[model samples]
Target chain A: MSGKPVIVFDKVSLYVEGRRFLDRADLVVSEGESLVVAGAGGCGKSFVLRLILGLPGMGRASVRVEGDVVVDGHSILAEPLPALQRRRRNMGSVMSGGGLIENMDVRKNIALPLNYHYGNVMSTAEIEARCDAILGDMELEELALPGRRPVSLNRMERIYVALARALVNQPNILLIDEPTTGVSAAAGERLARFCFYYRPEFPSAPAAMEEMSGRPMTRIITTVELEPYLDFGHRFALLANGKIEEIGDREAVLGSADPNVRELLSRSRKVASPGVDDADSAELPPGGGSCWRRSDSHWCHQGDRVKEGEEGASGRTAQAR
Target chain B: MTALIGPIQGLGAQVCEAFTNAWSLLMFSVDSVAAVARFFSRQGFWAAFRVSLQQVHFTGLEALPFLSLLSLLIGFTVIVQSLPQLQGMGAHGLIGKILVISIVRELGPIVTAMIVITRSGTAMAAEMATNRISGQVEALEAMGIDVFHYLIAPRVIGSMVSLFCMVIYFDVIALVGGFLVASTQLTMPWILYSDYILESLQPLDLYISLSKSILFGFVITLFSCYHGLRAKRAPYEVPMVARSGVIQAMFFVFVSSAVISAVFYWI
Candidate 1:
């Protein structure tokens, strides 16, 4: 991970109905790094993203926050409205259930940020071109048709449109909440690629780590399941008991002894490695090791550990040849 | 003594809550004004302008037919009933003054505001509440879009403009209806009726009518938005917020209209 910290959570604690949802959680995500925060459902994983955005409430109930979330060298909690808005402009967020504007069609919804921020400087044709490019990259051309409002789209389509809208501005930071929930396995892989190694030119081809040129986009994704994002993210953190309990490199996280982390790892492995009937296959690779399969045609066994030099600079493990 | 203390404490709490709400509403208005100013200086001018035009279309142009019908009925009823009485009392010359006082100065603005409150005001509240409940407001904020600039300001501007135009339309249509009734029933000359009405018309009457309409517009839209945003979540809260907004906006519209008229006429 790079030393430059782009987002820092300093002793951030949140309380809802006197229950501790976050207990002085501290995290630091650097520029061009991908961090996946996984937890059980309703475990306040989404709240962390909200806290980073300096939002006061979750859905309806207001959460009392007692710490600072600093983004791009500005404390979001203390920054004034205008400055905070400017800060948010540099970051893109996808809230749960894909918070697309109901009244606007999918195209308008995706074009909103661009139109609002760059409408004066950019022509309408330029804006439409940008929207069209992002829609194409996200494979959302069909949904971009006029009159396809949020209500008309299903859950997966809504999330995809929301992701497209967030990325249309080419935001430096992307905060996505549960992008793969209730989605098919193939769709989940596409979403993972979009969040991690997105390439506009080859939408279907797997994006190699070396192919991503320039400064990488910082991504902080929260999910109830971690299988989809296992191949991505520089670091994986498990949020349990209102605090980030275990966080480290993929191997370190895979070898953690925390019961909660073990359960999450086991669940993720079970989901990722389908058609395996052996109960031992569902459990974590024995001896604090990690196992991953790139395709169903080939299965890496428990002892097939990744060598130190084999890991990519972007923290991605070597692909199975 | 304890019973009295308990009741007094409850009263104190209620008063405090009322003051808190009033303070919040005042701050919201100030913020909305500031946002409107910022909206002009910032980007996205045309986008927000489009929303404002849509609001104007809904609140003003669409309500024209119903407003016209109601205005005519009111005008005919007033002239049909009051013209004979004035004639019997040898007060035919006072017809213009009476029409100006009752229809132009009072009923036109109030009835127009009532129609707005029923149609546009409730719809705005419900729409805002739905936006809030459905996470659209949060989405906008996340996108760095100001809710006041994009949503509230357009509605406020549209509602005010709509009320102003509707009041003027209501007055003119009602007067025409009055003239029709006077000419048909009493065989009054068109020249005589027009002369009486023109002679009685005053700048002060127009000022009061237009002022009340604008103020009513501000009060109704502000209250509706304020109450609508009060619903933080829950779909059920949308209707409740809309209902409360309508009641509060109607109450304030009446109170402000009365206060403005009393201040102008008496104090």
Candidate 2:
């Protein structure tokens, strides 16, 4: 069971606008293994995730999730709607903005996955108790009430709510995009530690729900750059254009002088590099997440927009828009 | 004549496409209705209905003041034109009858339909377009929630109810406006106005007018939702959908009003 691959993208390729986005991407991950697939934006980082997620039937490529994507020992493509829903319950994905429902307050939105997946498994008392513990654990003491809608809260608060919602199900797999891209470096480190540290603290949570699906022991396979934004992934796979060039530890992927790997890294730096985008360059705070300004009464974004660094300043990228 | 036949035939084909698309949309609406009924138990029908009511308030009530003002100007202008013509024959007393017939039998429904089409109709389309763009529609779908019921059924119901109420409001204002103009500008006697209005206006006229508005309400909601829900995922598509909604609503109302008038006359 440990050797069984949870997700396997077999020689998959995707094309958009009649031009190939990803030529052929082949990758595999087994239970209890954490991984980070890193590449420049538009270099098919999301394309890889999309195939594993089965967003489209075939994006000019064949995709197969070998062991189980949504549940244990079952192919995601073959599962029924109800079965697929059950699989999705075992996992949750968080985009950079956290995709909070604008109308529902933070608390209700966070409570959603709990109600969807485990309402019957956990009693009313246990559910409330668990929710309370998590809120305190994340230090979201004030936001636990979910009083205000998403629009009112600052960006970091929204990320806190987003992180809280992802953890509500105590999922086996968390597919996250740009986890640290919007928050302060300190907060990003805290988020990275929280996700990486989950393996040890809540080891029992995933096993308890193992009977619902085949795989358990909540493992996170995500995508990120370890040198700057985060530091704790077990594996980093080099992705360039639309293919995985190398798969190894951080030292190997980073230290390697492979032409393709060097090219991919060089290209990633250029994406946010103001030299190419100097036409509309703004001052960015030395560390990147989201760059915006907010006073008590004013939220003006004038001059060169540099990513700001502060407790709440980092995660407000989505809101600053 | 041959050139005329080609375009006329093409128009017949396009109208047929509208009918076919409408039928497809009706089937989709039925599916959503069933899904919404299922979720009704989760958040009681009254609560869901209340949310829908809020949609109407934002979508409907906000536009009423301007619509009423337009109706007033239309009524005053129409009566001004009618007075000189009616007076030429020494039948100036017919002013009230003319106003009543024009306002209730024709202008009320047409104007109401146009307003709903421009305002609520475009609003619904843009909202759905944005929902599609923001992945809200997909979010609803992923929850095993039928989008038609949760996203669209509410708007359809809201548009129908809102359009009807607005038309009634528009009709009332137009009448008062016509009366105010006749009394002040024409120095017409109150008895003449009242007698003419009472003698010419019928319950059937009001019923027919209201009924046409209901049909207008249905068409506006249908066209807007159909185009909006089927929006492209691109950013600019939302604006495109909104523009197309206005055009489609106008086309639908024109055909619907003509058919409705023909039917009323035949009956």
Candidate 3:
């Protein structure tokens, strides 16, 4: 984590349906840092991401937000719609269902942001080249056919396409919302792996390209299932009951004194080592613990199948490897 | 007293909500127009222009055959039904006046608008509602593409342009159909019948029809786009909004037709 903060939530509170979805939530995410927000279902994890993106419902009237949310050095709430949209150009969001436009084919969906922002400045060849680089980087070139709609791709491919779309603009801040929520566990593992892929390089327009090209990206990912997100970045904020129950280095939060934080870690461990009782899963695996889930007498972690006897409970953690 | 107050409050709330919705629709239509203006000056003008052309092709060109056929039928029926009475009374000269004053001035714009409301207006509403339901609208906005510019403007401008052209086409076709049918019965030369029709067709009638068509197009596009954009997230809302949009568009078309015709003819 760097010394400077790139994203800050200064006592931000969001009220929805006369209930506080996020109240006085405060956190600082440094530039180039990735923070995995872990919480129970409906803990406003996605809501916070929406707030950061300045989506329509995250405002004074609808969600009734209070306090300030500053992203990439500007108050998101203060900016008007167009200004917010301009600011959002630097932020890439992979919303649920990949937020791909069903009307557009896969290639157009990926190129939508590029065509919107730099359509005037960049040539068709340049835009295509950029899009090709992103697809190649995301390993989604197989589905980049000219006329292929989003429905043609399965759940996992859609998520990948969404990520590719988000990253096509080379946004500095990547806000991913539950990329693996509805996919098979195997696909979820692949999605987890795809989230960490490198941004592609291009020699096109230097202004939008330079800011995100060499600089380390700051990613804030929210997920319902914490197992897939366990290894993301170095920092973790445990959000529960519309508040950050615990926030610090991943290790510190994992071992925090807050019961909710401890419980969440334990729950994630349970997801990783399913079929094993809580007593047997006591020792937390070291260095970005394995996201392996034991199902039907085999260990599945990152698509590798290991028999239970050969890879005992202690040897299952393979995310860092 | 309590019962009266309850009913009164409920009515007041309903009125307020309706007024708010109307105001929001107006504002959204205005914003769409402004975005279209901006679209003209910006680099995206060509893309938006292409979309507008496609819309015009869909709403106007593709609709040409059906609209022309309907106009012809209408003109034939009006002339056929009224010719006997006029001939019985020896008022054959008034046939051109009747055709010009009725079909060209009144029926042409209103019927064309009704067709548009059924075809493009409902489709626009459904499409807009689908965009909202499927998250395409939000997705566009999130990508920094203005929803008004990218989605609504082209449809509005295209439909308006298409309606104007359709009205003119309908007028011409209807008059031709009336002339063809009247020639068989009246025993008049083609040139004299054409002259009578052309002479009765005052420039003021054309002006009124053209203005009404433009207004109808604007109203239909505005209402459909507004309703579609405002649809709830539920799947059922898509059909509901389309239905409501069509109904409202038709209502506005009829009312505008009456108001515009009265102002142009009666006043």
State the C-alpha lDDT per candidate: 0.78, 0.61, 0.76
Q: For residues A23-122, what per-residue lDDT tens digits would candidate 3 score against the true structure? A: 7888888877778888887778878888888772621235688989898788998988878878888888887777788877898888777776777777
Choose 2 or 3, whichever is better by DockQ.
Answer: 3
Model 1 lDDT, full chain set: 0.78
Rank order (by DockQ, best first) = 1, 3, 2
TM-score of each: 0.87, 0.66, 0.86
Which ranges of candidate 1 are over 4 A from the true structure?
A: A59-62, A199-215, A268-321, B1-5
Report the lDDT tens digits of candidate 2 across residue range A1-321. 245677766566666545565656666766655667777665656555544444432211333333223334566656665556556665656654666767677776676555444554555555556566556656565775646677777776776676667666666666666666555544554465445433212323434455533344333333445443224555667677667765576567678887655654453321342122322222222221112244332232323343344415433431222
Residue B147's lDDT within candidate 2 is: 49
Q: What does candidate 2's lDDT look like per residue over B1-267, in tens digits?
A: 998999999999999998987797777656655645664544324434555687688667988888879999988888878877877888867876797778878898888788787778888888777766666554443433334555665666676678778777887788778778888977867787678777878888888787777777766776787777677567788778888878988987887777877787665
DockQ, candidate no. 1: 0.50
Write out fnat for all predictions, comma-separated: 0.67, 0.02, 0.41
lDDT tens digits, residues A56-167, model 1?
Answer: 5754575688988998788999999888887787678999999999989999998898788767766777678867876765556788788988999988888878988887
Say which candidate scores most in DockQ.
1
TM-score of the second chain, each candidate in turn, equals 0.95, 0.83, 0.96
Model 2 TM: 0.66
